[model samples]
Target: MVDAFAEDEEPISLPLHASSDEIGRVFNEHAERRSATLRASTERAIRDHFAEAHDGQEPPERIMR
Candidate 1:
């Protein structure tokens, strides 16, 4: 399992006797955190692109689409 992560990432551990529900909960929490991080990063990238294309100001909402 340690080989699966990068040097800076920590390996996750579950109780030796963990139930299926417990394992599912752990995976769900990890996925939620990863999803949120990706979403914020994507938003930041879009904002940066719009600002650059619009001379440091965001374009009108309709044009964003």
Candidate 2:
């Protein structure tokens, strides 16, 4: 049997579905954020989610693997 402790595979790259025009249109119609600020806010949200989920905990060596 393969070892359970063996190294995990790396993550795959995700594809974003929006074209420039489509993204611009959506953002313009809905979001109150400018493009640069929207990007920063999105990144901050992701970081916050990860931080809160993993806070004060010992994660697996390959937690998301």
Candidate 3:
């Protein structure tokens, strides 16, 4: 699992006065950001794998089907 806070970042703690909706928004934003990061990393790994196996040729279009 990915760490919530990076080396220079601080952990988020909700204040006692935080509303339910405000807390939900914070969780949603964090989830979306993490999802995007994972998507990009997955794409890079797939491309690298194809490149090594295909001797630098482009991956076949059929792979997407």
**1-65: candidate 1 lDDT, tens digit per residue:** 22222422535679999999999998788767766766676677778888887785756664454
Candidate 1's C-alpha runs over 4 A off are 1-10, 56-65
Instruction: Give residue 54's lDDT in candidate 3 (0 to 100).
Output: 84
The TM-scores of all predictions, comma-separated, are 0.68, 0.34, 0.67
What C-alpha RMSD separates each model from the true structure? 6.1, 15.5, 4.3
Off by over 4 Å in 3: 1-10, 60-65
Question: Which is superior by TM-score, 1 or 2?
Answer: 1
lDDT of 2: 0.54
Q: Per the 3 Å backbone cut-off, how many clashing residue pairs does candidate 3 have?
A: 0
Give lDDT for model 3.
0.72
- Residue-level lDDT of model 3, residues 1-65, one tens digit each, is 44534521434578889999989987787777777777777778788989888895878664654
Steric clash pairs (candidate 2): none
Error of 1 at 22 (Å): 0.3
Residue pair clashes in candidate 3: none
| lDDT (Cα atoms) of all candidates against the true structure | 0.68, 0.54, 0.72
Worst 10 residues of 1 by lDDT: 1-10
Candidate 2 lDDT tens digits, 1-65 = 33322422333333398687877776564433344455666667767777799897654443445
Instruction: Say which candidate scores most in lDDT.
Output: 3
